[model samples]
Target chain A: MTEEIIIAGFGGQGVLSMGKILAYSGIMEDKEVTWFPSYGPEMRGGTANVTVILSDTRISSPVLHEFDTAIILNQQSMDKFEKAVKPGGVLLYDPNGVIHPPTRKDIRIYKVEGTRAAVEMGNPKVFNMIVLGGYLKVKPVINLANVERGLQKSLPERHHKLIPLNLEAIRKGGEILEAN
Target chain B: MGELRLMKGNEVLAEAAVRCGCDGYFGYPITPQSEVMETLMELRPWETTGMVVLQAESEVASINMVYGAAATGKRAMTSSSSPGVSLMQEGISYIAGAELPCLIVNVQRGGPGLGTIQPSQADYFQTTKGGGHGDYRLITLAPASVQEMHDFVELAFDLAFKYRNPAMILTDGALGQMMEKVELADQKPRWTREEILARSGSWATTGKTPDRQRNVVTSLELDSEKMEQNNIRLQAKYQQIEENEVRYEEILCDDAEYLMVAFGTSSRVCQKALEVLREQGVKVGLLRPITLWPFPSKVIGEMARKVKGILVVEMSAGQMVEDVKLAVFDACCCVPVAYTGRMGGILPSPGEVVEAFEQKLLKR
Candidate 1:
């Protein structure tokens, strides 16, 4: 099975890192994975996005025109990637700061109040992880155990203490997700 | 499997250099490829393996440094993007003229002059058909994946020394920045002074002794006759490389009625296009040339005889397509050749490639 995903948001929203964590989790499960980012000037402060692919066989193109899932964090990303999602695919987003919500009736739309959830959890840094947890709730392509291992692999040794907090944020994310 | 890790293509290039016993890396940082030097600096190979890593003043200085280090029979390399690579052309020519073995990586970006920092394959003509002043050919390897990016460092260095000719890894910003799971090779120790002397002792300028004549590494031969002979010898070496060093990958070509020829990032896109086309009941195949300099003309010629039409896809405006045309020209086949691509860092999607094939070749 192949799952092609696009995670997009403002540069600091951890869009790239979210894709990286997912890719690492795929690798931990012995799946072929690729993480392709939108780099250079756009990454400075503009919209940032990453394409993550996990497949049973070797992956072909990292640059794709469509995605099986689009995890959009901002209104701009929702505006841009909502149409790019496959007809019957999934569109997950955070409702914070979004002016217009996704209106696609063909695809499954879900919202996770990640920004508010992170603030409530007393650490806004776990916003991306919360959103990731929401994605796992919907898809569950990768197991939670592998995701913990992925967190261990991706985070530095000094940051190991934050894994539990991140896991807490992830669980909160799964709990707060709303079907739209 | 030596060590499995998910790494960006540029970072893996540096890691591979360290693991493959590279002696020195002299490079100036540039976008889409600065991670190469950054990772090398972070690793500090000097502390572990005595490898020298320097930030040169400019691309010109870095390539000349490579030339100098290579003169001592050391595995040396430098990397840059398009405009920076353009600056190193003269030094690259000098290295090739001196017949010094070295690796030069161009993690290419869009360019005519300081173009976008995004990926593009526009350097196809410049790299494959002599970017430097004289008639010199760099053994160019085009890597489509991050894994190939890791694997080709040692391969390029080996080929460079095997022929005592400069070799290059011609990749784009897309492949350089993308991350993928890679199984890195085992670490190999750097060559000792004694080993360098023993292996390249015949002609290396490693402080000549009384047992042999002074070995002078120079590309300058003022005499016209001597220069002509030098060119002749270089041409012969290039011919030998063409015969033995051509590398390419064929996907589903046996039953294909049409074929697509591409390399690097474009090849990856074409792979998807091949699948899309096949799903639409189109019999298409893909030929990915791993060695861009050798051009894989023989295989293209052989494939052209069987296919009805061929589509050449690149990130440039029909650069490698010329070589594809030349390859098919000699086959004496009436097959048509079409070109499809994107420029200035925009990658063509698989749907676009499929549309181009149908529009140009099938006239639908």
Candidate 2:
């Protein structure tokens, strides 16, 4: 019966892909889910945002004006979406790339340098995985085990060898942030 | 039921088509709808399951291939967005004239000219009111959910064969690009080629038979009276679909003072509007027409008997509202149907639609 979460950042930061992982996890948990992204012109270096709604009942609207959780990967994203995070909600920011920080005091902000963490693991593209990992621990919208299975099924057979790396990135993200 | 996977809407549609054992698919590259072709190409259905996946050079050629495949009583389909679909009107007319069953899908983008690659529902008139010439109707289905994207493929084929007419799955870019969960249906009880061919071969041009006259398929005729008869037959079939197969969904309209009507993705936003409006203690209802051609006029007319006003919400500029007006004769019963929406891929928020429903249907 919970509401919505929004993930946003500059293009190529894999914001939408991370949102998709959450959507897959939510659906695996038998929740009604819907995902929407900024398409076309708004996708090229411009700000990108995706809305993911997971609920115990049918999802009436896929569009969310505010968020129960907000994830931003860059300063532009934080500048655009920081104020839009729902009152008394949660916020996550990439500690590696963002310069501007939200001054709001009501929401919990988790600063995980997602790209730097993925690069430290020798795969910057797995930044999606790092964000995915942090999302799992932060929002219990679905089971972490199920999200891993979804990633396995979604990736190609040739890319199966990389699943463990992605999982490792997620684990590192969870460990690195929760310790801080 | 199965575990959830992250897949694009177009990818989901192609997977559903293959899982349903669809006989043939033909398509060209068009934004918003191009993924349909890309997924089918990647699926290589023929190498896997004897499914024929062919990419045509043009939308015209793709639709013609659909016409050819459908003549054999096999499940055949082609997809494009608005401009590409415009090029397909010629072939759609030919398919209609020949009375062949085919499924067409339009993942609409903003249009009139080369509208940018975003979601738009502006193709309403071009779809339901005959984008081609002569008097004919395509069984147009507007799906609001990704699950509907999977289910409606079966439903489109069923309705197409049930009437020997072309059916279109009218979706938009939002539905095509978005990701969602789809629990595919069981496949053990599906229709086979043998059964469909047996039922359809009597009128189809399968082969030349010595015992029977030469089988030829054509929409052309030299006889004027026969052409008139053919038109009348098409009209009669349209009437059957209109009277019997119209499908729509109504929410809280019986006690509603205000009503909102929208289809496909727009209807989903209207649903959100219903949620917020009710929280603010507004008596607004949403009517979603699943079948765009059948228009859900009868249902809306019935609801008009109870409600004081109706607000038409669409992704287009007032195309379906015309039907609402025609359905109620614009009666002076406080059942006045008002209209508002945007063009191309810009979807109004639940808040914006709620504002319109309140302003037009409640206050005025």
Candidate 3:
């Protein structure tokens, strides 16, 4: 099986890193994966996005227009990517700053309080982990063991001590995600 | 199995360069290609393999630095994006004229004038048709995967030295920035002074020796007779390359009726489109040119005779299609030749590609 996902948000929201960790998790699961970012000035304080593909076989194209899942973190991302999700695909969004929620009826929509949960946990940087956890909760294609291994692989050795905090953020994110 | 690791294309290119015993790397950072230098800095190959990695002020300076290093019989390279590559054309032309061996990587983006940071194949003409000036050809390699990004660095260097001419790895922003599984090559030690002297001692500026006369390396020839002779020599070498170095890959072409020609990122997309078209019972095939300069024109000409139509897809306004047309013109005049593409940072989807094949080529 192949899972094509797009994660989008503001620059500092860790949209790209989340996709990276997810791709690494796919690697831990012994799967083929690819992570391609929307590079350039758009990554400097403006909107940022990344396309992540995890497949059982070789991946053909890294540049794709459609996605099986859209992880929207901001109003702008939702506005742009809501319709990009395939029919019956999952659209997960963080409800912190979204003014107009997604109204698409073709795909499954879920709201995860990723930003609010990170705020409660007293760490804004964990916002993306929570969002990633929410994605796993809906899909659950990759297990938590692989996710932790992925974090170990992606994070620096100095940051290894903070794995517990990140794991907690992920669990809280998975718990708070509600289907709409 | 060699150490399998997931790495971005640009980073893998840097690592491969170090592992391949590259003597020096001089490059200026550009969008979509900055990671090449960044990875080198982070790896600190200077401390490990004694490889010299310098951040030059401009692309022109970087290419000249490669030329200087290569003249000393050292394995050297420089990398830049589209606009920066344009600035290095003069230096590149000089390197070719002087018959120096070096590698140049162009992670192309949209063009004409600082178009966009998005991936593009617009530089196809600039790269294969001799970007600089005069009658010269850089052995161009178009890599479609991150693995090829790693593998091609070594191949580029080998080819560069084999013919004593510049070799290029022509990729795009997407391939440069994308991450995938790559098997890293084992580290090779830098060449010793003895090895350098044995290989390039004849023409290299290795200082005057008591036994042999001093050698000079220059492209300047005041006498038109000497200049014409130099041009003839260069043309003969290019002809040898064309005869022996043409490289390409044909996918599903044996039973194919419609042919699609693409390279680099566009070829990977075309591969995906081929699968889609096959599902719809369309007998489509894909031909990807690995070596753009030696260009597998003969194979394309042969395929043109059998296929009913041909579609040339690119991330530009169909620059490579002109070559395809010339290759097929004499073989099959009745075969419909068409071009469809996306530019300015936008990538065409498999659906769009199939639609173009059906509408433009199959319809005819």
Number of the top DockQ candidate = 1
The list of candidate 2 runs beyond 4 A from truth reads A41-46, A178-180, B2-4, B186-194, B330-334
Write model 3 residue lDDT over A74-120, tens digit each, in one string.
Answer: 89998999998999999999888789999989999999998888888
Model 1, position B110, has a per-residue lDDT of 88
Candidate 3 lDDT over residue span B282-332, tens digit each: 999999999999988899999999998999999998899999998998565
In terms of docking quality, how is candidate 3 classified? medium
Q: How well does candidate 1 score on lDDT at residue B137?
A: 96
Q: Which residue runs does candidate 1 get wrong by more than 4 Å?
A: A42-44
- DockQ score, prediction 3: 0.66
What is candidate 2's lDDT per residue for A28-102, written digit by digit as tens?
A: 677877888877655568778888888898787776567788887878778778888878888887766777667
TM-score value, chain A, candidate 1: 0.97
RMSD of each: 0.9, 2.5, 1.7
Native contacts recovered, each model = 0.80, 0.71, 0.65
Deviation (Å) of B70 in candidate 1? 0.3
DockQ score of each predicted structure, in the order shown: 0.87, 0.69, 0.66
